[model samples]
Target: MKVIIAVLSAVLLHCTQAMAAAQTGFFIDAPITGIQYVTSSGIEGQTDQGAYQFSDGDVVDFYLGEGPSAFHLASVSAEKWVSPNSMTVTHTRTINMTRLLLAMSDFNKSDNILTVNQAKISQPAVQDFLGELNLIELDTLAQRYDIEIPSVGEAAAHLQSSYQYIKQSLSSDEIVYAPRDTELRDILIKTRNYQGHLCFYNVDEIDNPSYVGPVGSTTYKITNKGIFEYPDNGDRYGSNDGVIASCDVDLRAKRTEEEFHEVSSFEGWSGLFACALKGCTRTNLSGYVVEEYDSGNSYKYRANAMTFNPSTQIVLNKKQGLGQHEKVDGPNNAEFIWFTFASRDVTPLSFEGQWQEKQINKEGVSYRCLDIKQGQVWATPFSDSHCRARNSAGFKNASVEFGDMWWLQSSAKDLYFYHLNIPVAWKDSNQTQHYTTWEYLPVSDSLNNGILYRYQQILDEKDQSLRTSQVSELTKL
Candidate 1:
């Protein structure tokens, strides 16, 4: 009986020795699997503009097994749980992979103790992905634009693949630590290729305790398929400003540098011409011609571009002007006619295809031309009978000046008139009579010579004779 008891004691001692050895293999305080814990208030579906928020001071649970035992929101301290944002835990508590196991082995629940067979845990995939993500800088602009970045709660979501990868590449010498910034979470997420480059917007780093929000914003692409372009505001609209600015990405690249291929670019005045006359019957017609816009008051400004020309079938002279055999000027101020028409010898101006016309008024016409797009003006002429009327039937080129606005006349002269001032108002030009884009040009003062009946040589969509107005305003005189 004594021999049997001795044998049992030896066996028990051997088991005890084995257990101690196993315990020694694991670091007493090795980091547990879970370091992230969402606050109690972070139940689900709480967001501002589809963004989730995280608060500090939440008690996180680190478990021994990756399968059933991992870190989670086991509980929270009463003092720390009062307010979600109030959970400010001291940074003094540092938990890592090496020390987590040693710190919790004495717990009654074995599952609560973090453990691994080896002293070091390796995960290359997680590390590789995290490493790649670390190179990416997270800015407020990136967040607003929806670029992927890391967050505190994202590691567990990708634990299986990420953990195994990091484990394979991990070594005792080098350890992967928890990212201080949550943006690393975004880098781990696999996403589609982005086509647009980044353009930094604003920066406001002073608003938060971490001084993070002030990093500003940058515009970048979400997809890499080389799809449509993204405007400055990140949205496409139908306004003149939107359409005019939405030039082809490739075309912009060719004109600018190769780097701008990924940035937004526009042709400016050329783009406006395209928007105004694209799909017209005379799309083939090209050459610099005169285009005018009204100033906020009573003046007008005209610009000359090579793309401006009459796209109509009407017989016109080589030069576009009042009477036959007269020289017409380019849209620029250098070519603008400043005649007040106070004398009978008012010169007849020649137009494309041998057409000719001239102003007949003798009361001294006066007007000024402004270039709103360029924010400048032509020779500010203040004279009498300054308005000029086109004898042609083309309505698109005709313009009528009202109290304080200029309306764009369409081919049909019956569509919604576009407001020149605000650019977005496609409503009726005259409040008394609701007009369409192609409706009759409304006149304000008949004696005041508010409307200048002129016609552009632009053609219609069906290859029909189309004439549109460039601009109209009150007689500057």
Candidate 2:
């Protein structure tokens, strides 16, 4: 059951009357009829992180416009203290409509009661509450026999019923947020005035639950549907020649616990090196390392999955070391708190979990290296270079060679590269172990791929760019 405990805050009075032209055709110019504030503590204990509660106030502003009388809750704002507190809010249009229905002389005071002749405003829910307040309940025979009671004065009857339905529904664990439409009607009935005068809409009591948080807690922002447009027409070539496509994507990472160590240090060890030392900025990475081997112990590899802070690119190393991260792919300098690195160069002949320094023959030159996988050096006596020596004509077919590989060092120096074997898979499955997940999905093409690459020339260099790279879908799991 989801029970919502609404805590009302102490009333802070600051009512002002300001006149402005109506933005819609149905706007009104009613003076300040009445003002009131209400706060609520959300359900659950106070210490529950991210729990939401709120404070709201009513605005009795009325203006003249087209259409029948109606009211709406426009905005809600809350205080910012560490403990929850109250904030101000507005609901003008709905108040005006309810006032019109009541047909009262004054808008703010709850002194007078006007009769509603038409059944248009009296709904089934409203009638149910009125049945409880009828004078028929005082009759002995009616009470003894448990007879049904008819609705009283229409205005009060409907108002009471509307209020009761909202209260009952709100108190139930079965309900989450209040139904915006049903509650809007209650506001309309309470704020109506027949003489075309706007009035204060108030109820002496409301069945808000116990205040759970401080006082005012959560805030809500209101907006109409006409404010934005999502252009999703299966535009495959979303971006090109100044045009952009809509897209979004998510990436995850994994590592082999046995094969990798959270590189403690990589200062002086060597055989081959591939370090990125661009603008050494810190990045948050969340991925895993992997270990692979073969008969000759040679492996080929690469970093496949990715996501990082666009401000700082992600960096990885075969051996653990401390340094700033640089962008390897994605944005120019995207930073990531989530990343994974794997060694794609090297073959393991035999290894033992003992730290050792060793050398491998690459083009007759011995290079120094260390392995966290076995934590032992490669013994030259037991080593055999299985150089299949296939057609090395730039990736034509399958082949192997025990020669030196090359890569760029952080100092922009050319360093011997190695061959490592790393495996990768692409899947966006959300299986949470602790925290809730919210996926920000960007628009995808017909194929449902989150990324789209297009060739374009902003100046004279034609290059590929990711178009419409923004969040387009969201869901909590």
Candidate 3:
């Protein structure tokens, strides 16, 4: 009897030891398999565009189980869209071992469903997508009068491919810490911000330049009025200063030494001339951006290459010192004429041929000319009418002794947008040594003439002030 009892004790002890040595693996109920446990907010019917995919906006559970278990369980949580602007846990806290073990056990679950209670998932996740109607919009303005609007692919293709173009810009390092989530969150917010206008309109193609007969070969003009931030605030449609922008796009333009390949590169434009004022280099240009933004919206272009003009080199530092109110440029003392345009995507669904034509004074504007892809906007008269219209200011601010103006110089009018800008540094006519990619343009009233007529404000509380005010106003008359 004594031997049997001793044997039973030894067997029980051995079983206990075996269990202790083995790493505890768990089976998660469907939802927690991926970081975005809830793919839809209850309001979604199926991709209503109002639906929510809580990948970035969701607060998810983080377990440090990539390697050996520390036996010490830590509870880390974060809000993807919050200010300190990171998904990392601000502080660490301890939780009951029982709850953590349950969460950790589900880590290895094959089922990818969010059956778990929404409350249990995390804190500050998106509860509803349509709940806040801060939707994105695309607008187009024909830059050239006789622009040969190119044939375009489907919206699904551009949108899908755009997703890839932006994804490629995010380096592996930006997401190494939390590999699964927050990788593309930066661009997502940027896209949200740029599209957050208060009131926008559907551009109508006009036959005649409202002011005169024929201005130039390129007669297309951009008329934008009141770009709103949210649907709710769009009610006050009459409050925005509209603009009429005319330009002629040259398809042959090329960009050089410009590395906006990443969204974060845009963020580096933190302070005033951080690069130009201090002198920038290819090596340090990457450091100039403070954060990566959704520059993709600016890239809704017709041409594959995003450039101001041929051979233009975007100086990383010239875009510095811009504030939320940077659009308000005082009387030009500066000749560099650094300007950025708030463009709405105007690409057409299909093209009959290169030259887009419409009856004069059409009710709606159709984007039929050179499709604007992305980047800051600069104007060089494409036609005699356009040239004369803008010439009201004076003679050429400067001369373009060099650049890819061969076609324009040789073309009929013997002219092209003389000023170079976008994808890099641009200069006004006064610049003699502007090609160094460090020169600033002369600050003229006309420099920002195109971007002068717009105001955007937010109406939704959720989208109003995540980390900063969701309001933006720009007047460059």
Candidate 4:
């Protein structure tokens, strides 16, 4: 009797678990509406309130229309909230699904409640257009329909396509076929409006907020208009003619809370070179060095010194002499912190002009001028009071011109600046030939108390180790 009771209890637990897994869930990435979904367990229906019912361990496939003319969108795992990010299908399918939703949203421009028309999508021409459609062609269709689609690329007025009419129809669906649920509609609208930049790093975290990590990290720029550009060399310095893609990207506020915390200034250093006239002293630095920038005219930062000694070995060689130290102070240090606050009215084109360095005196504090001209960033010394007048006259012979710099404005009107291809020389274990490599500086903006905080990555040349460290603070002037 005892054995039979134990077996029955185990069976009941299994059934309960199975039933919980098969519960109803919603599809989101902003709660897509009026789409058909089929589960692996053969459960099929149109998503009501973005809802779907499925058995445990079921794979859900989404579609547009029914039968022969149906367009198979994405196949993803049956979960509480299925989204493009949750898709189990290939990346191509995920991208296409996202594009389709974006196109639908663009068509229904009055609100964020994305409702698709089955009659329009089921048409033969529309199916053909969707089959051959690439992301770059969305804008052309938007214009033909006299509708605006928020994208990251420039509008090509003369872009010709054979399926132009089909695209236009898809962009401007005439009949509202689906039932409107005001309560459900509001939920979708709220989710869509709250969407921020789809970054590689979680923007919610204060530490490692942006893509400030290892060398192999994905480095791409998405403009306010929705144009996505991925540089071949990983840094967007020289030219953006490499590869262009489009997505639902926006430059929104990364962090919502208003708080400030200081991180280690020397978070990525393996060792420090304490050099003198006669000889150089090498001291292995461990852990992190936090610096407070409450008030200071000059700020000091670290860079990767070009050397063959591995970071692991350098840490082991604590307080040891490493011959005569070369006067190798690279262009990694900036004399003054420059702040650029972009108003909501500023467009990408208007923000791309040459910026001259101006001496700003705020709260009785004088700062050096840092200006940009034709992608080159010129940093002037604070000692030179006449830097502003000279900068107006084309100060080509400035103190330092960090090559090929760029800036992007976020949706919250915060501006981010970057310096690319800064050279760092290093050697291998075999001590073969001295090779110079480039490093990228992605400026962080953690704003608090009228001051914009910036963090920079310090690289260890020997082993290519990288860590994000707080470098500078910019106060609004």
Alpha-carbon lDDT, every model:
0.22, 0.19, 0.21, 0.33
Worst 10 residues of 3 by lDDT: 182-191
Error of 2 at 292 (Å): 67
What lDDT tens digits, residue by residue, belong to model 4 across residues 1-477?
A: 999999999999998886776778666434446778888778888876467888765657787666644545555455544444233111222333455565553233243234666666666656555443323234443354443343311111101110132133222322211111110000000000111111111122213233321111112221222222222223121113422211111222122332323223323322221111111211111111112222354333321111111111111110111112233123321111111122221122222333333222111223454454443445544542433334344334342222112232132122322122212222233443232222111211121112222223344555333333222323222
Tens digit of lDDT per residue, candidate 1, span 233-322?
212211344322221111212112112232233334232223222222222222222233345542333222111111111111111111
Q: In what order do the candidates fall by TM-score, top score first?
A: 4, 3, 1, 2
Best-fitting candidate, scored by TM-score: 4
Between candidates 2 and 3, name the one with more favorable TM-score. 3
* Per-model TM-score versus the true fold: 0.14, 0.13, 0.17, 0.28
Candidate 3 TM-score, C-alpha based = 0.17
On lDDT, the candidate that comes out on top is: 4
- Return whichever of 1 and 3 wins on lDDT: 1
lDDT of 3 by residue, 1-477 (tens): 999999999999987865453321111211133222121112111111111123221122232222111121211111211110011110000011212223322332242222223343332211111111111110111111221222222222222232232234321222111111111100000101122321111111112223210011111111122111211101111112333321211112212222212222323443212322233322222221222243554322111111111011221111111123223233211111122221221111211112211111112211111111121123332231211222222222122432222122222122111221111112335653121111112112222111111112223444432211111111122
Cα RMSD, model 1: 34.4
Candidate 4 deviant stretches above 4 angstroms: 1-21, 88-99, 105-112, 134-477
Report model 4's TM-score to 2 decimal places.
Answer: 0.28
